[model samples]
Target: MKKRYILENSKSLLVLLVLFFSSCVFAQQNNTTPIMENQFWKNVQFGGGLGLGFGSGYTDISVAPSAIYNFNEYVALGIGAQYKYLKQKDYYASHLYGGSLIALLNPIREIQLSAELEQLRVNVNLEGSNSNSLDYWNTGLFVGAGYRSGSATIGARYNVLNDKNGIYGSAFMPFVRVYF
Candidate 1:
């Protein structure tokens, strides 16, 4: 299962990379941002939100904070992190990590797409191993779609990550962004 997940994720990332690079080349040749005008953060923006994420264990509340920088109107770069607490029926688990060098594509008004490669660290404490903790690192890629209007943005994302313990995960995440 882990091997299969990695294969599928690799293919998806390759497709996203091809699309991203192709769009960038097209934009450079055209010499213009795809949308005429947008209230995009002029090179830099900050965003954060609270939500629920379910996977691995059980549903839990989460806090996600992120920052984005626009290299140009059509392409934006991002770095962000998420901390989530897992509320298992019999135990609790939490993780903290951050990522860098993500990309966003906003070729049209009111719509945006994104892709990212991220590195993560996780510490898990099962009931039996409270005295002995496990630490692991991972690589992940995610894809998302969203709509933005005024100061509010909402999106849904899907992520595939390869864990250090030879496990892989596929997660579906939905999020909201507020710009000030």
Candidate 2:
């Protein structure tokens, strides 16, 4: 089952990469003026989120870093990676690592819409009397809308592929995104 999931995820990622690179090639060919290869880097933006929380017997820490290439004022494509750690003193501890492919559209200056495909690997270890360990992968396909200002966007997303037993625990998530 795990192997199947990994294979499926790999195929999806490969498809996305092919499409992305093909579009880049098409755009370059359509342009009459010669564009320097380094110019591509100029339009790329890098950003992500970091979180930390600890109190009592619980702790949570997360780091996610992403980069996007702005094709124009209205469209952007990006990729991100994330890592998270969670623990409950006498309960269980978990480590999650993942990656996502995201696409953003700006219909207007104030409205932003997004679609993202995310895959995560989860590992958990149970402590105490009945000790056990589990490992699995979770995938999410999210669609979202937000209010944009400058380089920031505040939004909410719904995971169309959400599963109750998955890592996020909820199909709905709120976000504050920035790219610069």
Model 1 C-alpha lDDT per residue in residues 130-164, reported as the tens digit of each score: 46556665556678889977656689877755344
Error of 2 at 161 (Å): 0.9
The number of clashing residue pairs in model 2 is: 0
Model 2: per-residue Cα lDDT over 102-155, one tens digit each: 899998989999998887888999997564888987777899999999999999
Model 1 weakest lDDT span, ten residues long: 161-170
lDDT of 2 at 99: 90
Please tell me which predicted candidate would have the highest TM-score against the true structure: 2
What would the TM-scores of all predictions be? 0.60, 0.85
lDDT of each: 0.66, 0.88
Specify the highest-lDDT model's number.
2
In angstroms, give how far residue 158 of model 1 lies from its true place. 2.2
Report per-prediction Cα RMSD to one decimal: 8.3, 3.8
